[model samples]
Target: MNKELITDITKYQEFYPPNSLKAINNVLKWKNSEEELQGTIEALTFIVNQTLMKIIPEGRIVFCTMLERLDGRFVLLDEIQGVLNLNNNQMGKNIDELKNMG
Candidate 1:
């Protein structure tokens, strides 16, 4: 795995635990196999969505919006920004505006 990707995955360990990382790594090791990669991606996506929902419910929507974009499903970035807006009141004051700073 690339160092940056490994670092990113490691950052999620608190949420996913080491066992989840092992499973994901095993699956990604076989990523050269098309079927395996597809299955692994599906499983990982599920785990990610579930974990994020618990950690940050509003962020889950934003993450899913990006996931759709990653999957080439034609999601508009603005739509994701809108979801963030709706959830921002619960998040914090000034947070909604901060998101647009990107």
Candidate 2:
């Protein structure tokens, strides 16, 4: 999925917090079959949940409800790959910060 697609979902901020909405939308824009969608959603949700769990000080950031409202799983995988493709140094630094926090 493209960042634009994720940003497109950000338009729905009325439905979810802007950051969570962007993350969910980033994953949902990808087209996938129902069975694949379910598993992909599960895995992607776990990745996002884990990342947040690593970085955040406390509380929870739920994705399943927002994901159910849209459509995706591999979309999450694709979005993550998209993140990996990013060249921004700050992204790596942020990840380092998370690792250090953990």
Candidate 3:
């Protein structure tokens, strides 16, 4: 499957109305293998970290907290290192730094 589609799906989540609660499946409608789903969330977390910072810094921090919780439970070692292989974009670098932390 194309990774860009996953990234696009993550961005599409932002278009949905602000709801009090939404299942992750609802947020990511496309079914993925467990690994693909986790990878998509990782991608979203990195992208959101940059955008949310500029738009809503407090929200960015809150989102990061949420990502931290998810990462604690599901993120993998190879996923972190794989981020380093992406283009030298800010989000990629941010993710790489996050990898360094663990």
Instruction: Write down the lDDT that model 3 would get.
Output: 0.46
lDDT of each: 0.48, 0.41, 0.46
Instruction: Put down candidate 3 lDDT per residue, 1-102, tens digits, no spaces.
Output: 222212222332453322322367567676566676667666777775665334333233323533545845876657644443344365544544444554
Candidate 1, position 8, lDDT = 22
lDDT (10s digit) by residue, model 2, range 20-100: 333454587755556655676667677766664343211111122224334644456675444444444645453444445
TM-scores for the candidates: 0.26, 0.26, 0.27
TM-score of candidate 2 versus the correct structure, residues matched by position: 0.26
| Top-TM-score candidate index | 3
Off by over 4 Å in 2: 1-31, 58-102
**lDDT head-to-head 2 vs 3, winner:** 3
lDDT of 1: 0.48
Give every collision pair in model 2.
40-73, 41-73
Pairs of colliding residues, candidate 1 = none
Local lDDT at 97 for model 2: 45
